[model samples]
Target: MERPYWVSLTSGYDRNEVLTDLMRQYGDDVWNFAFFLTRRFDAADDICQEVFIMAFKGLYSFRGESSVKSWLLTIARNKSLNYLKSAFIRKVTLLDKVIPRERASPSAEAVMFDRLESAELWDHVMQLPRKLKEVIILDYHYGMAIKEIAAMLQLSEGTVKSRMFRAKQRMSELLKEEREYGI
Candidate 1:
């Protein structure tokens, strides 16, 4: 029997079923990556949707130059970075209006306490400088090989290795600080 049209497209054809399969195969992973990148649940949800839409639209450009995972991730990374850049700009603009608060509402305090206790140690991963954060997330969190990370980031293997070393050192310092403060 002939393969279904959607099956052929998701397997690399011009078929709608391919899009559904792609979503089923990658939706969760992409969402996780977006969540890690944005650190905001709502923004991550939006970016995840946008990433898949962009991927589906550009499906025809998948010239077999890279694996489907890599291609999808490239799109996601670009979209997320653009969002971060815009958010940074907005943060800069709103700096005068934003103020740190010491007192929290009861609900806010509870939420904060819960996050403090329940958050993973590595949740601090996002607090690192972007350069170090990238290496740590790609190497340790995502479990990408050093060479693979190097290629993905367009850096030399030695450079990625050095960045990983610095990221580890910074992470250790951050963890120690967290422990000392009981956070």
Candidate 2:
């Protein structure tokens, strides 16, 4: 029987090997979570890079109590919050004005089709309050268990459940309003 990759990585394994595997497996997830929290592409890139660096430096302290993905996401969430609080971040709004949005090519019909299909629901999800959005993304989009989410977010399981319920209620209300408006 083979041990799981993370199990081997945490059990006195080679540092480079463990770091490489961790980055390969969870890098995109960490980046996506950061993007969802920050809503800025550049910030997400910085957050993702910082997360891997922190994870590598703190690797020995990892107790294997949670899945590696959850641990990485916790780091990402903290870094994103810290970044949001920094004065340096406030000075960057000027750059937003200078950056031009990329235009999609006309040949990208599949991309357009997919966006049109999911954009409405995703837009509603994005409109949710930060806490509710985090819970919904972690639970539904990432398929994390409720217990894992509680551990990752440092919330009680009941709190996580309540947030999920509230998020669903809010989403339902948004959809109802859209329907009434014939949108």
Q: What is the C-alpha lDDT of each candidate?
A: 0.69, 0.83
Error of 1 at 41 (Å): 2.0
Where is model 2 more than 4 Å wrong at Cα? 1-5, 8-12, 94-117
Query: Tens digits of per-residue lDDT for model 1 on 3-116?
Result: 234222444464466667788887766766666676555566788899888877876655655456656666777777888789674684366358633434444323643677
lDDT of predicted model 1:
0.69
The true-versus-predicted C-alpha distance at residue 103 of model 1, in Å, is: 19
- Model 1 worst lDDT run, 10 consecutive residues: 1-10
Best by TM-score: 2
TM-score of each: 0.72, 0.83
**Candidate 2 per-residue lDDT over residues 60-174, each given as its tens digit:** 7877788888889999999999998888876675566687466456323235436676768877988999899999999987889999999999999999999999999999999
- Cα RMSD of all models vs. native, in order, equals 6.0, 3.8
Output the worst ten-in-a-row residue range by lDDT, candidate 2: 104-113
